[model samples]
Target: MYICICNAVKESDIRDAVGAGVSCFKTLSKNLSLCTDCGSCGKKAKQAFHRALAESGASSNVVSIDAMSTAPVRRIQSTIKVSASATHHQKCIKTIL
Candidate 1:
């Protein structure tokens, strides 16, 4: 069912956003832009959102600000090459091959 006609937001969209860890109205609005237009669907959308959260078993105590971000997560790769890991001053040619 469509919750917000202005933004074309549906009930599934709110549920999906909630499943993705959107715990508050701000994040839900940022993600779906649901109740930002004429404010008519605000109450319905909020109810659906809360219902979805309850159905999804999400706690109100936990918060995730990044849940609103659609950016893909990235990992930083790094490498360290130690020539000599010994405490001695001996000349050792250690290769990480």
Candidate 2:
């Protein structure tokens, strides 16, 4: 998927960069600039970063994906749910009056 249309940065581009030792967001921003422009693709870029890290055996850098994919097959496990609203840094949880 094309995460950054303005820069022509695809998800695979980010992944390959991650595999080549670009692990964290700071380095990713500096190296790939996937999230520096419009800011619309930041979240997806971050997701692709972590996925790339996990897939490339950078297990310590990526927690959530590793937890989901390589987690033990035990009886009970905790799952972290991230809402779309949260992705864009909006706190949408509300209370009824």
Candidate 3:
């Protein structure tokens, strides 16, 4: 159900955004960064956005969040140390892949 695995975005999250007055894909993407990584989920995310928008019955007047204050933010650790990776919790995040 996670349309954007890189960002951990789910379809239900999109629906909730629509319900909360996100009337277009661009605004929603700005907040949640949908389809921003890898671009594999662009089609599916767009489809879900439209479907949710239609179901929400909200206006198509192009409402925006944060008024385009800044680019979407994603936090990343500066580096991963081997000792930290040995911990079970961090092991999953800093994995062999």
Candidate 4:
């Protein structure tokens, strides 16, 4: 789907930008000229941009959740407690080492 017909920017392009660390509206405008001209697509573009970001986040979350649900969860071993007084500070003889 085309977000800005004037600039020939597509939804996929926006998604790609979002994936490449383009987070906010200003960065998006600089990258793709979104809402730069007549600004007719401003609202729609913002909506699509946010939607794309949300979808990407949701997809990643789903993948992680699925992996957690399917993978074998191991039981934790015995927990160890150390006394604060047991801590020792060793000085390196090599000054910087």
Q: Give the alpha-carbon lDDT of every model.
A: 0.62, 0.61, 0.63, 0.58
On TM-score, the stronger of 2 and 3 is 2
Give the lowest summed-lDDT range of ten residues in model 2: 88-97
lDDT of 3 at 68: 41
Candidate 3 residue-wise lDDT, 1-97, digit = tens:
9889989999999999988876556667778897677989888887898788778776343222333446332111222233532243233323211
Candidate that scores best on lDDT: 3
Q: Kindly report which residue pairs in candidate 3 clash with one another.
A: none
Per-residue error for 72 in candidate 3, Å, reads 32
Better-scoring candidate (TM-score), 2 or 4:
2
Instruction: Quote each prediction's TM-score.
Output: 0.60, 0.60, 0.59, 0.56
All candidates in order of lDDT, best leading: 3, 1, 2, 4
**What's the CA error at residue 58 for candidate 4, in Å?**
8.6
Q: Relative to the unseen true structure, what is the C-alpha lDDT of residue 35 in candidate 3, on a scale of 0 to 100?
A: 62
Q: Which ten residues in a row have the lowest lDDT in candidate 3?
A: 73-82
Global lDDT for candidate 4? 0.58
Clashing pairs in 2: none
TM-score of 4: 0.56
Q: Which ten residues in a row have the lowest lDDT in candidate 1?
A: 88-97
